[model samples]
Target: MGTAPATAFDTEALRRGIEGRDAAALLSLYTDDAEIRVVDRNTQPSHPKIVHGRDQVGEMLNDIYSRDMTHHLDRCVVQGDHVAFTESCEYKDGVRVLASSMVSLRGGKIARQILIQAWDE
Candidate 1:
């Protein structure tokens, strides 16, 4: 019997990146042409904030991780070329944020992601 092949996505690295607030590490998981669509109170489903390319995504990640907040990778599940994860964050002022993401992988790197987030108002 043949053994199952290992998946290319690194969940441990993802955990470290998210929990550690390491934007660069997280950015490394994406392909050069990767894209991210974000939906939140400001950017509703009808008009999501779209970030294209690794550079743009990096900028967003940097902005997010730079905030005075704590982040936790709550859950992650991977299947074939797809991954889904939940993240929770708390700001210094006690505002809590929750985010869920679904990602599509291509050749071991993230090709596209859809992120939905909500926070205490």
Candidate 2:
């Protein structure tokens, strides 16, 4: 067959995708069956709960943009097909929070994502 493209996820590319708020680019990073879990800082297990799915992930991002005007990635680490990062942002309501996210890539597309708040106060 032909040589395969790199299977690794590029942190910088993903950063640009997120920072640029490019939904198509962001979606392109994810696999068809990608899983995404998000736990809001103020949310608990008993509450509405974590979000899951590729489309859901996109929806969440859209919802976030509906509120927050901007979001910035502070740092990221890429290992094999996985990437983890920390992001800081202020919501449209002016609430600031730090979020830690872990992503798994397969065939150069994101296969899963686990995100949680990374703050004590």
State which candidate has the highest TM-score. 1
Show how many residue pairs clash in every candidate, following the order shown.
Answer: 0, 1
User: What would the TM-scores of all predictions be?
Assistant: 0.94, 0.75
Best by lDDT: 1
* lDDT (Cα, tens digit) per residue for candidate 1, span 26-89: 9999999999999999999999999999789999999999999999999999998999999999
Query: Which runs of model 1 end up more than 4 angstroms from their true locations?
Result: 1-7
Could you tell me which 10 consecutive residues in candidate 2 have the lowest summed lDDT? 44-53
TM-score for predicted model 2 compared with the true structure: 0.75
lDDT of each: 0.95, 0.72
